[model samples]
Target: MISNPAKEREVRPAPPDPALDGLLTLSSAQVLVLASGGCHSGYAGDLCCCLLAAVQGALTASSYAQSHILAPGQALALYQCGEFSIQSVGEGVCMLVQLQGDLPGRLLASRLTDSAAFFPRGGAAVREAVLSLSVLEDEHALVSGTAASSYAYTMLTNLISGPSSEAVIGQGEPLSPLVEAAVGIIQEEFPFLEGLDELAERLEVSKAHLIRTFTKQTGISPGRYITHTRVEYAKLLLRGVDPSITYVAEASGFANANYFAKVFRRETGMSPSEYMEITPRKEPPKRDPFLW
Candidate 1:
């Protein structure tokens, strides 16, 4: 759990997902569980085959002029190229599984549209399988490709056609018009703005009401949303040629570099340099690909 003095609110993280309970049973595939923040966006232009599972938190994806919000226990399968934006709602984490082998593109072609994109239930076993593969990779300090292709194919078949697709898609509770406006304001002006009191004043609402309303609808306070937006901005800058961490910090509107580093590490498990080193300068072919 983490606290934000900026809003005097405590963020009690939800229990970790148990989707990986069968990780040891997984026989094929190489997987990795990656930590991600509540807000971010990107494009995936050349991904061929991959699965994305949301073990924790809610994820909203928009592409092809359509949008889908994936609740916990849901997975999204992808097998083609397109630009997409995946945003974590509140505090969340996702898993990525790069299935080995030459996958037939049309294996998933029938269910690739927005209406058929998300698999709503039975995510735990799949998630655990990926975790098991990740453990194997970590133990060896190398990825073993032997028999991985068979395993990846099995995982995909199970996720797509193993069970009847009767799971209900999730939709967030709609925000009141005022609360929606507040969110828009924070997102638009956060880089140049600070604190929620001014925002509340501008909206003519009490700070307590503003905090309560926003948190109730989004599960995070307005102050924290601003922080997320700023941190997300820093992530984008760090991936680019910002000259130095100080420059990135300033660009993201942080008061100083040291503070920025502390918050960045806490929110995202890695420091800016470590993130830059591991994250490709160019967005990878797969963006958030791991599903149940």
Candidate 2:
């Protein structure tokens, strides 16, 4: 994990990656990891800026006039006129990309203004790009910076081009208190959650009622949500230094290696081993230049 000392948080320049070649260049960028309760605040100035993704955990991002919670796979584009702050609700990690040129104009035209626009679920391509950046190996830090810039550009473009309906939150009906509580418990305890029955028991609600309300509100069943959460966690582990399928399986809360493989394949269209093979082996950056 990225180390954060009590007095300061280190921010490292985006390491170069050949895989990110052919994308738009960025003026500046950095990746930082926040421990529980860590906070990073800054001003946007004249550049186009965004919290490209909260790669892991939950974050509370706020601007002078607005604030929103960003879960994993979510992003927020900042309005250039104000100061903004991002705080980890728990242990969190995120990337900041600042761009020059016409990108800011494009963002303003796309309706980014006083309020920061939130991208609820940055689709698969965006997810993969962000993940790749998050896991870049520190050993390859000497490579060209083109790839890293391109990847950042690609993520921003994809987010801006998405349908606006899915980009904004707070417009729809708020989730029921029961469903919200259940989601909180799932996110925090996904690695050790026993089953739907256990979750229902914790909330003092019947299993059927819990399932119906959660599915209706979130568009996915609790069991499936649990599996998805496990799979997301597993993806991070599989992409990490460890190469053992069994270790990843147990760590991700699967009952057994065999069952883990089955569920993994069903969710990702590949076995754990295959997924690892495709992920690049990179170390975390050792040097840091910025502080948060």
Candidate achieving the largest TM-score: 2
TM-score of each: 0.41, 0.53
lDDT of 1 by residue, 1-292 (tens): 1111121111111221233211211122322222354444434334344456654556776666577787655777654435655677755555555332233244565776642256665343244345334444545654344323323444555565554212111147777987877865654344456678889998999999999988887777778777776776566545432226775676566778898889899889988888888754422122124322
Q: What is the lDDT of candidate 2?
A: 0.61
lDDT of residue 122 for candidate 2: 48
Poorly placed runs, candidate 2 (over 4 Å): 1-23, 26-38, 52-74, 87-95, 104-108, 122-130, 161-175, 184-220, 226-292
Alpha-carbon runs more than 4 Å astray in model 1: 1-37, 40-43, 99-104, 114-116, 164-292
lDDT of 1 at 285: 22
- Residue-level lDDT for 39 in candidate 1: 48
Per-residue lDDT of 243 in model 2:
43
User: TM-score of the candidate numbered 1?
Assistant: 0.41
Model 2 residue 4 lDDT?
23
In model 2, pairs of residues that clash are 20-147, 137-282, 137-283, 138-283
